[model samples]
Target chain A: MKYAATDLDHFSESTLHTIPLIEAKHLNLSFGKQQVLENVSLNIHPKEIVTLIGPNGAGKSTLLKILLGLLTPDSGKVVRKRHLNVGFMPQKIQIDPTLPMTVERFLQLGLKIQKRGFFRREYSTTNLEKYVDELNIGYLLKQPIQQVSGGEMQRILLARALLREPDLLVLDEPVQGVDLQGQTELYQYLNQLRHREGYGILMVSHDLHIVMKHTDEVLCLNRHMCCSGHPHSVSQSKEFQDLFGEHTEAIAVYEHHHDEATCDHSHGHNHIHLDETGESKHND
Target chain B: MIEMTQFLVFALLGGIGLALISAPLGVFMVWQRQSYFGATLAHSALLGISLGLLLQTDLTITVIVVSMVIAWGIFTLSHSKQLSSDTLLGILAHSSLALGLVLISLQNSVQIDIMGYLFGDILSITKTDLWLIAFTGVLILLFYWRHWRDLLNITLNPQLAQVEGTAVKTVQLQYILLLAFMIALSMKIVGILLITSLLIIPPAAARRISDTPEKMLLISMLIGLLSVLGGLFASYHFDLPPGASIVLAATAFFAILQLKKAPM
Candidate 1:
């Protein structure tokens, strides 16, 4: 299904080596008097996951929508690779109460593209069973989508998005309603998925603490690109500190702890307690 | 006496056909909460009616065109940042109805039954009207047969459907155009005032019992058909207005079904 790129000469050699999944340059969008997005430029390449982090009203959603071509930008350009397939998992889709849709039926709605002919033939993709098992939504498959919990719904949405076998996975605040533990598991699962499939993932997230662990890069935005780099660099940068304030200094960018077996080089664990006169209690 | 019987048969046939035509569209109206949109179309139909009478054109076709034009116009105008959809629908519904009444009052030559236009008269349904119902009924069935999945997907989520390459705008425009047609044609069956009820109630009732989308469609059609029949029978027996009788029958189904719990 890969079509040869005809405009390969237009890009630089570095870009020619591997085409980016999505490239947006200086995108600007506004609604009447309110400027929502300004001079936003970013790129998502395959086999990488980039996380978008911004405060409320920072136009993260607007930028994501623009990249997906749902909303028109005032002035800019977004070039998606030819025949690029995007599996979008929205924050939440409100289905009307009148429409009766079970989880299985909800997922089946995603199958319209693969369905052929008048008979439909019950089309099934190879990843359907695999993702269903991976996400552990087998029990929730038959239940009404409205009845499922928020965590379960996120997993189901992820499962449905995975079924598309997308070249790029676009998620908008995917773990909004899920609890703490569930969020960690979801991000872990996403990391595994990205590593296995080599799909480019562009996700919008609000949780700064947990997401930075698995995220390769974080683009901090506020109606424009403030700063963007790898987790450690972005977290330590003055732009991030100014935007988030001093409280962010304590936040670890990634899980600093590793199993003893994984890291053979062990540093000495020493703690000295300060008593009334001097450091009295010492442990090594 | 035979003429009276033939007229009654025409009325029954027309009622059944119109019910079948309007039922599926009604399901969408209920699901999308566009009952007021139906009412707006029905109200504006008075302008269509007045225009048809003044111009010596086919009333049904004139009404359909007029409603479609109005629907398109409203869609275009609502894009403006000035007014909200609720306000626009309200203004259009009342102003069009008022203007229509004024226009009809100016026409001195042809005698018009305003009550019949409002509440409907089953006995007055002509053979041509019956044929239009048959034509529209079959057309609706063909449309449902060809584009049911696309229409359902669009109704569920237009943006999602569009991303899936479902031709959302075309399906939506077609659905709205067909809805305008139904509102125009169903005028003779349930009259302008009761058209929305006929379009909404049976489907809402069907929603109570149905598990799947296909089942919902079937049950809606059946309920609508039964309402027409039961209404015709009650109108004949109790000498009530046929359209009102039909609506009451549908409401009875809603009430009766309300007693039975929705299945797990």
Candidate 2:
């Protein structure tokens, strides 16, 4: 638990005192006869990153859709602060080949739709170049969106989401196609954005090791709220170990050497050894 | 000779109007992979034709209304999860068309040229059809001008669009209704059977040559206009069916463009 407390680190401690950017209260949903989500609730405050991790079909996406107001929960509701602008990055988007759209045009499309209410002043206009350069997607701008590689597509999508200049960013598997090295860079970048802009980030991810180091809260879901707490505690919890099995040990180690603010520290070669074990378990 | 000249002018104007509106709409249909949806709408339009004839009402209005209703029906039924959309579309398309044919055959006193409805009589375009196409073209342009970004956002991903504050359902419903109106208006020039061809071929041809959505829309419109002009000329000289001639001309463009491989 010993870690350096920087000026940026104070926000994590003070987040609970400030009103949440978005809050979900005892949400429940079902599709026909099957219950999809049950009594799930979570809060996302500014300068905080909450990662939702779950097994396949664990209602992770369902919860996100509810949080975004894309789907109405059968019971319970999501509350957002007035004029809260949300930037969403979906898992993957399949653009029809017949629709010829360049990456730059895709980013620009985000700027075209005027968000409802008066809260879009912060994002202003024409942040497309800023995000494109930051995400390192400048070279892919003129290329057709459909032609981009998977990793490039992820960055392009992230850039598009960032162009919205949202107060809260909801990313679903934001680093899906990115390599291990790119994943760390993206997490570092997101951490920077959170600290610099005081924005709240809610992401769904399966990359427990990388995400664990960066996220303030981890909501482990399996059609219900299995566990919710700091990533370190959640990884050690019985529910997490039961759900994720052998991967918890590696994540716990990954979480220890890393602190929220610093990204330059080494993970030690022993951590890589654990990552292979986690991957091999995944194959089984 | 003057009457012939007037007939050609009206046909050209009406054909050009339809082509202009079809470009943006057809490009979307192709992009959304809903080409079958357009065909389904056109097929059910025959039911509207039969109803209009049976009720002795204005055929165009009734056809437009029925097309809208069918389009709405398709939109709602697509959520049922009972069958794949293509299967559902196929069932609705042929059944409504069959019902229209059955209803038309039941009428003993009225004499109608079934071939004219099936293939179209573009050379016999009246002033009323021209006005309706012009009005629809205006409406399509206005709607698209305001909602182009929204529509493109939705096409990229509806959930993402919804999150970004675009009313996905409302925008989608409006687009579908406009598609119905366009299909109804196009029936007179292309006929119910060939209407989808007019709505699909130009966009498909344009895809080979254009590198952006806006460019595709523009190229499709140009291709559509050319098809109308070339088809009219060929039909005038060779005494061929204008609707079929127009579709063939579009197909020719699509074939010729395919020879130049599009850059990946």
lDDT value for model 1: 0.77
Q: Which candidate achieves the best lDDT against the true structure?
A: 2
Listed per model, the TM-scores of chain A against the true chain A are 0.81, 0.84
- Report how far residue B123 has shifted in candidate 1, in Å: 2.6
Q: Which candidate is the best by TM-score?
A: 2
Off by over 4 Å in 2: A1-11, A112-124, A257-284, B79-83, B110-113
Candidate 2 backbone collisions, by pair: none
| Fnat for each model | 0.28, 0.87
Write out the backbone clash pairs for model 1: none
Candidate 2 lDDT by residue in tens digits, A1-284 = 11111213324556747888998888899999999998888888888888898889999999999999888899988899999999888999999988888888888887734444332322246787788888889898889889999889988888877887889999999888676677777777887888777789999987777776667788888988888777777777888899888756667544655464563323222332234454433311
Candidate 1, position B52, lDDT: 90
